[model samples]
Target: MGTRWTISTPEPLPADAVDAVDAEIDRIDRAWSRFRDDSMVADMARQAGRYPIADTDQPLVDWYRRLYDLTGGAVSPLVGQTLADAGYDAIYTLRASARVPVAPAWDAVIGEHAGALELREPALLDVGAAGKGFAVDRVAEIVGDSFDDFVVDAGGDMVISPRSRGLRVALEHPSDATKAIGVVSVAGGAICASASNRRVWADWHHIVDPRTASPAREVLATWVIAPSAMEADGLATALFFTPAAFLRGDFDHHREGFHHVTIRRNGSVEHTAIPGLELFL
Candidate 1:
């Protein structure tokens, strides 16, 4: 939510198209942004209570629940407290605490009841793993309603409308932003990527493993393509801790129609054999 975004269409859109998209993004930020004190998520951190869940936010909550189970709890929205303790707080404090708090299991701390979200205890919630992608999908929907074809790019997590030509997306090297390891032609749907090198401070990155309450170091980068940006974004983070085979086989990612590539710490690459993706390494 802190990054830039771009919307591209074949021709000039209506004058209010940008305004509509901007309004939707602002609404999403107000509802879920952990960096803002006035956000609904921030209110949850301040106190434990049954907070109303907007109908638009239900998809995000449902996706979080799905990813929580898909990754076996490796990806969680409940990692906000740990992230803040590790120096990624509302004020952008990059200094890690002497003792970072452990993230509680999702079921142990939160529940959904009668259209409301009830937190058993006060805990900061971070939905960065997939929130951006969800926003991208929403934006795409707004744009699609006006134009049949469009491209919505949110800090590189994108949703491209179906086109015969497709869109060529470069997979940036984990260690060097100037270098690219491969390219994929995204014909349609969404493609989301996560890299450890993007954010770093005091031996920590944004991607934290909730199980260990520490930064995930095994995989340097991950890329996923799915029917929706939300799925792709959530799965990209899930790939950091879970293997592709298990994700595809056990979690039925294969049936769901997605492909992924992961760069490990040793400079080795692990990926699925799928069309459209080509790796130089």
Candidate 2:
């Protein structure tokens, strides 16, 4: 919630509804912010052993599990301490420090227990991969069915509900936000873009690979469209590390479809069509 959010609808949001929206965002921030002391996640990470998992943590955990499998650990929530070690700490300070954080074996720690779920490891549980997209989805609930059409843009990650026409979004350069690489059209769903362009400090960026404990260097940015913002957000991050072949595997493209656009570090774009896969000119 450190970023700004913009809501655009056919009509302006009512005063009370705006207040409700703000409150909901604040609630989510308090639950998951590792930078805030009052946050349950911060407290659990600070304690770093055993703590009761909140109901809210379930969504985050479930998504992380799915993403970890999908990307083969390329998108990992257990890299929280790794991020901190790299200078992205509690206060958002960036440093040149590089240290491999202790992996308490998330498998050994997180699972079904007697009455409550617990994280036995010192895992910090970084949900940056899908948190923004998930939040976008959740915030749309505030707007409800009040408006015929609306769009929520949380720092460029978005959820658009269109009554008639689809929305077109420009894809920005990973290193330079001002320059755009291409534009994409989405009718009624979520679009999530994960970039190494920002949230960087020293010699490192925010995106990290849990397997090697380093930043993913192949793709600079990735955009994904899915049925839900949470899925789009999660898969977009995974797209940074996922190969194009995976999306076009055995799955049918029409009935159940996924589209990906990946921007490489060398200023080239690779696009996986909803029904095909190819690189752009």
Candidate 3:
């Protein structure tokens, strides 16, 4: 949601076409924003411990639950508590700080759902990954009926249709914003790049690993391709919490329509089993 929007219509769009797409995007923003007061997700978070039986929120809850399991609790909504402890208590300050915050307990804490989320716990439900990708997916659904080809860039995450020659995306250097570490092509589905540099506040950013309750080390960025924007979204965030040693194993296990390219702190690159993965550059 922090990213901008760029539309490549197969043909020059009528002025109304732009307005319509913008309206649809705005609608998506209202429904899925984590910070917007009117957003459905915000409402659910506000109700947290109050909703025991997941209904509409079930998909997200179920997805988060799985991540909680798969990563041994490396990714979580409960990371809110960790953020507060590290001084990222509010949105305004977090936006201002632009720092990668390490979870105070990452080395020791296990992120398994201790129990159903409880309001009493000093935890926060930060849906940084889920929010934007989900919004992009929703936008695609809304626009699919009208436009056959389009790309939605929600921060660094994206989803595109094969309507274009091929979707060319740039991966920003983790330490340097102006330079692109590399570029990748996405077509027919979704691709996302999650990095430590996108948003930092006081040396702290929103991506938090529930395990050990801190920031993930070693990998600077992970570029992933998946069947859905949502999957790519979660996987990219998951990469932040995972170790490079485990990269191959994870790819082999879940590798399907997915491909990945990762940049290390030293500026070297490693890729998953994605075919012609180097073609994008």
Best by lDDT: 1
Better candidate by TM-score, 2 or 3: 2
Per-residue accuracy of model 3 over 41-81 as CA lDDT, tens digit each: 46554553432423334465556666555677677766755
lDDT of 2 at 89: 80
Which stretches of model 2 miss by more than 4 angstroms? 48-57, 102-104, 113-116, 247-254, 274-281
lDDT comparing candidate 2 with the true structure: 0.74
lDDT of 2 by residue, 138-240 (tens): 8887876567588989988888885465676887867678877677778878888888877876667888887777787888898887767887888888877
For TM-score, the strongest prediction is 1
lDDT of 1: 0.89
The lDDT per prediction is: 0.89, 0.74, 0.61
- TM-scores, all candidates, are 0.96, 0.88, 0.73
Query: What TM-score does prediction 1 earn?
Result: 0.96
**How many steric clashes between backbone atoms does each model show?**
0, 0, 20
Residue 270, candidate 1: alpha-carbon lDDT: 84
